[model samples]
Each structure stands twice: as C-alpha cells, then as structure tokens.
Target chain A: MERSTIDLWVGIFVALGVAALLGLAMKVGNLTTSNIGATYTVTANFENIGGLKPRAPVKSAGVVVGRVSEIKFDATTFEAVVSLSVDKRYVFPKDTFASIFTAGLLGEQYIGLEAGGDDAKLQNGDKIIKTQDAVVLEKMISQFLYNKAAETPKAPETSGSTSSVVDALGANPLDNTTVNTTINTLDNKGKTDIAQPVAP
Target chain B: MIRSKLLTSAIRTLRNIGSRFTERIWRMGAGARLFGLIVVSSGECLRRPRLVVREVYFTGVMSLIIILVSAFFVGMVLGLQGYNTLQTYGSSEAIGVLVALSLVRELGPVITALLFAGRAGTAITAEIGLMKATEQLSAMEMMAVSPIARVLAPRFWAGVIAMPILAALFCMVGVLGGYLVAVPLIGVDAGAFWSQMQASVDWQHDILNGMFKSVVFGVACTIIAIFEGYDAPPTAEGVSRATTRTVVTSSLVVLGLDFILTSFMINI
Candidate 1:
C-alpha cells in the first residue's frame, strides 16, 4: 500500500482502538456520565456501602441520571462518603433521598435516588442529608439467624398455661407451642391460628 | 516382563521430552539476548519510520480481519452459553456482564495472542528465515549494515504495537456479536444487558489488565519469531524448522506468561 493510504488505514485503526476503549469505558464500565452535557456534584454519607464502588450508576426513578464519582471514609463520622454527579438535564429537589440498590439481585450495586416534592432544587456541592446505606446480605442473614435463635428461649415460656400462652403468643412467632396450647384449649385450632397475629 | 519393558520405555520417552524442553529453554535464553539488543536498537525505528509502517501494515493490518472474525464467533458462543446457564437462575439479563467480563478479561487477549502467534509470528519467522537462508542478512552485514537495526527491530516493534490494538478491536467486535445473540436471539432485555454490564466491569481492572497482557504477549511472541529466524541455519529445511519452532515456542510462551500474569493480576 502507498504511504498515504497506509497512514489513512493506520488512522482508522487507531480510531477503532479508541472506539473500543470508549465502549469498554461507557458500555461495559459505568464511568461517569458527566460529560454528556453538563452536571453538578453532590455528596452523601452512608453508614455502610457494601461493594458500592466508584463509577456505579446513580439512578432516579429507575432511570440512570448520573454516576458515583468518589468514595471515601470519614474518620470523625465513621461513615462512607460518596460523591455523585447528576446531569444538569435531570433536576432533583433538595429533599431527594439516595439509597444503594443492587442490580439483578446478585449483580453490582448502584445508587438509587428517590425524588422528593420540594420547591428548592439541589445545586452543585449540595449535600444530601438523607442517604441510605447498602444492605449487606450477609449481615441480614446473620440477623435473621440470630432472631431465630433468640426466639427459642422464649419457647419455654409457652407451657405456663394462659400466661405462657400470652408470653409465647405475644412475644415471638417462631415458638409454635402457643398454637399447640390454643389448639388444646380452644378446640378450634384453625380459628385460633387465624385470630392470633404471628409475632416475628 | 512386558509391563516392565513398557514402563521403562515410557520413562525413557518422558526423560527425552524433558531434556529437549530444557535445551529449548537454553536456546530461548540465548534468543532473549537478541531481544535486549533489539530493544536498544529500536531507536532506529523512529529514524526509519517507513520501515515500521511497512511492518505494522503487514503484521497488524493483515491480521485484523481474522482477529475480528474469530472474536465475533467466540463472543457469540459465550453469549449463547451465558444465556442458557443464566436463564436457569432466572437472571438472563446479566448476560451482557458475563459476555463482557469473559471477553475483556480473558478470552480477548489470550485468543488474540494465540491467533497472532499462528498468523503473524509464523510469517515473521518464515520471512526472516528465508532472508537468512538466501545470505541476504549476511550480505547486509558484509555491507557494514547491522541486520538487527535495519530488519529485526522494526518488525519487532510493529508486532508489539499491533498486538494490543488488534486485541482491543477483537474485544469491541466481540461485544457487538454478544449483543446480537443476547438481545435478539435470546430475547434478553437490551437495557438490562448494557446497564448490568456497565455497572459490573471495572475500567481499570478488566480492560487495562487485558491490554497489559496483550502487550506482554506481543513482545514475547514477536521477539521469539525474529530470533528463531535470525538464528536458523542457512537452508530450506532449516528455515522450515525455524518457522515451526517459532509457532510452537511462541504459543507455549504466550500461554505460560498468560498463566503467570493472571495469577498475579487477579489474585493480587
């Protein structure tokens, strides 16, 4: 090929490489959506951010409007500080609430902003006072297990006749002895199970 | 008696293979010295820019079509596999994440390197080996021109640069192929596919690490091919032997390096 033609092909090759890089960055990697037109930065603090990394999409009403720009830990508050950039086109009220949501249940996490009905508009460097942290599945599972185990001790309180019935029925849903007592006493088991609220 | 004889023959064959592998490693070490010399002489490439362009046009531009086509097929297969497996979990939407991760992180670089070794690496060795067999390198040396600077360095740099670019293109094409299969054929939601993919794949971790692997493979493959060609005995049989060695050895090196690089990049 001629040198000029080679040069043109080389340019095309470089452009293709750059396009690939951009695709990887934008389509495969949720890099900041800041450069589309204009954007404003806002900060939020959360107690926990489970696997919520930078470049995670910031969605509002199930629509992506921005991205998480930076994440840092504040020693004084002991909270994870996340900076988000929202597009200028999509405006949010001052009382907008932000929560971390997981995509596809087990997939990557992103921030979901719930719009509030407020007259004031959130501007640059605006700090969102209301923020919810990422819900850790492991912690939730552990809590569930602990609650189950704790309810077992309350089961011994079931055999105290009416008082036991009251304690077991009133206190925990896991203890099934209360239902047995009701079955024995009321002679109408199905009605009792329906009448008593299962305390969990 | 026959069992013992068979065992002894097996042991002998294994020993011979082991010894040959060690001998190849020794030759590779010697060849690596040529790599060092080529690195030092690469400044000559900038001075003779046309030579680099020619070599790049040959190795990189020539290999582009095959690289793109193979990557597309590989990606389509990945999409089908991911869809079938993920549909069992009721989360076929994550297909884009699966396809992108597989292509960008591992398949793109490794497969591209293997294809490049077969295509460009063999050609470089054959071309240089033929030149050596014809006493062209000798004539250049006799004319007080350094063959390493004039011939090997340009081609070496070209291959090295071409590799990462080709691998990147392969990944891009692979993503499109995946999109075609996942969105239309499998009936996955287009929004979820791209959104999940974008959320999951890290720009620094997956994409950069893949590019880094391709660059290393590129350097290793091109160096091995050129060295084998330059060191081949001046004969037709010797040139063919060198070309074969280049393919096998470059492939082995690329795979081995890939393993080492993966362990370091992923684990650490």
Candidate 2:
C-alpha cells in the first residue's frame, strides 16, 4: 500500500476504536448514570450491610443522589461504617435516615436516604445516626416462624370458652384437654427450634 | 542386558528433559532482553510515525473483519443462551447484564487477543523469519543498521496500539449483537435490557480493566511473535515452526496473564 493509503486506513482504524470505547463508556457502562457531580462525603453505620458494595447507588426518593464510596468495618462498635458520596446539588438534614434496601426480591443492595425534620443541614463528614441495616432473609424467616409459634398456642387459650362448651356438652373433656396440651407442647417445641438458631 | 538398556533409556529421557528445561529458561531470558531493547529503541518508531502506521494498517485494519464477525456471533450466542437460562428464573431482563459483563470483562479482550495471535502474530513471525532466512537481517547489520530499531520496534508499537482498539471494537460490536437478539428477536423489554446493563457494568471496573488486559495481551503477543521469529534458525522449517509457536505461546500467555489480572482487578 502507498504511504498515504496506509496512513488513511490507520487513521480510520484508530478513529473507529476510539468511537467504540466512547460508545462502551456511554451506553454499556455506568459513566452516564453515576457521574453525580461535586459530591460531598457522609458516613453512616449499619449493623449489617449484607451485599451492599462500594459504588452502589445512594438514592433519595428513588432518584440517585450519590454513591457508596467506602465500606469499613468499625471494630470497636462491631458495625459497618459506610461512606456515601452524595452530589453537592442535593443536601440532607442532619437527621436523615439512611437505610440499606434491596431493589427487588433478589437484587443488589443500595442506601436509601429519607430526609428527617431537622433545622440544620448535614455537612460533609457528618454521620447519619438513624440508619437501618440490611434485612437478611434468614433472620426474617426465623422471626416469622417464631411469631407464628408464639401465636399458635395462644389461639386455643383465647377460645377457652369453646373448649369449656365442649366440656359442658359432655363431649370428651379428656380429649379436649389432651388436644390443648399437645398443641401447647408442639408450640413450645417450635419456639425453641426456631429461637435456638437465631440466638447467636 | 535388557534391564541395563531400560536404565540407559530412562537416563537419556531425563537428560533430554533437563536440556529442554534449560533451553526454555534461556529463551525466556533472551525474550526479556529483546523486550527491554524494544522499549529502549521505541523512540525510532515514534520518530518515524509512518512506519508504525503502516504496520498498524497491516496488523489492525486487516484483522478488523475477523474480530467484528466473531464478536457479533459470540454476542448473539450469549444473548440466545443467557435469555434461555435467565427467562426460566423469570429474570430475562438480566440477560443484558450477563451478556455485557461477560463480553466486557472476559470475552472481548481474550477472544480478540486469541484471534490477533492467530492472524497478525503468525504473519509477523513468518515474515520476520523469512527475512532472516533470506539474510536480510544480516545485510542490515552489515550496513550498520540495527534491525531491532528499524524492524521490530515499529511492529511492537503497532501491536500495542492496535490491540486495545480491536478489543474495544469487539466489545461494542458484541453488545450490539446482543441487543439485537434480546430486544427484537427474543422480545425482551428494550428499556430494561439497556438500563440493567448500564446499572451493572461500571466503567472503571469492567471497561478499563478489559482495556488494561488487552494492552497486556498485546505486549505479550507481539513480543512472543518477534522473539520466536528473531530466534528461529534460518531455515524454511524453522520459520514454519516459529510461526506455529507464535500462535500457541501467545494464546497461553494471554490466558495465564488474564487470570492473574482478573484476580487483582476483581473486587470481592
């Protein structure tokens, strides 16, 4: 190939490559969405962050206002200290509630900020005190089971008059007592089974 | 007598293995020295921009068609397969994330490097090897010309410049192919497909890491090709063997380096 022809092709090749890179950055990557300008850093402590990663979105009212910049474990408090870089354009009250929330049933976690009624605005490096930790599925399921077990034995006791009615009608008073006793024992067993795993 | 013969054979095999191992180590040292020389004399390639441009034209522009075509096919296949699997979980929208992440993080750089090794790398080895066989390198030396500066540096710089661009093109094209299959063919929600991809694929993590990997692969592939050529015996058979070695060595090095780079780059 001639010198000019080779140069022209190389030029075209380089241009195409640059264009492709630009396209990737703009369309396929998070450059457009996560480019929150002029960010101010704030930190919040959480008991558990679950799967919340650094660079996860920090949103207010479903709009991304910042991103989680750093996640450090506070050894003294045994809590996760998460630093969020919120866009300077948006400000929160000092008492803003920062809660880790999942987008869907099985999705990545992000921080959601709910503004609180405070006279003073939050400054950079200020810690948000009212923070909610990520909800672990195992804990939630165990809690539900515990509540069910606690409520189960109470149901029969609340309807004690009905059981008494069975006795008044002379329809197997021993059977009624036995059924109530069995249910109470089963409920206690269920409570112990569910509570043991969660105690730690 | 049979037992003594067997012992002799075993000893000969051991000697052969030892010699081959030491030869490999010596070759590695020589390759490293050549790489250093290329870096030192790379100023010539920059000074004469036309030489590098010509080499880029040969290595990069020529290989574009293969890179683009394979990328498109790979993307379409990923889209079809990812959608098939993800839809079963009722998360077909995440097909975009799967396709984009796989292509940007792993496939784009790796597949492009493999193809470049097959195409441009082999060609570089064969051409330089042939020139050596024809005594062109010695002729240049007799005329007080440094072949490393005059010949190898431009090709080295060209490969380095062209590789990341090719990989980027591969990624862009691959994503488009995936989009085509997902949005129009498979009837995925177009908005969800793009939005999910954008949300998951971070620029610094996914894109830049991929670019870095391609640059590393480029250096490795080009150096292996030039080294194999420069070290080959001045014979047709030797040149042919060097060409084969270029493809095999480049592919292995690219894969091994990719694993190391991924381990470092991925944040757990």
Instruction: State which candidate has the highest DockQ.
Output: 2
Q: Which stretches of candidate 1 lie over 4 Å from their true place?
A: A1-48, A54-101, A111-133, A138-200, B1-29, B199-205, B260-268
Clashing residue pairs for model 1: none
The most accurate candidate by TM-score is: 2
- Per residue, candidate 2 scores C-alpha lDDT tens digits across A99-150 of 9999989878999999999989999989999999999999997666555545
Model 1 clashing-pair count: 0
In candidate 2, what are the lDDT values of residues B169-215, reduced to their tens digit?
Answer: 99999999999999999899999999999999999999999999999
Every candidate's CA RMSD: 8.2, 10.2
Tens-digit per-residue lDDT, B112-228, candidate 1 = 999998999999999999998888989999999999999999999999889999999899899999999999997899999988797678778788999999999999999989999
Name the Cα RMSD for model 1: 8.2
Task: Give the TM-score, chain B only, in order for the candidates.
Answer: 0.92, 0.99
Off by over 4 Å in 2: A1-3, A154-200
Q: lDDT of each model, Cα atoms only?
A: 0.87, 0.93
Candidate 1 residue-wise lDDT at A156: 64
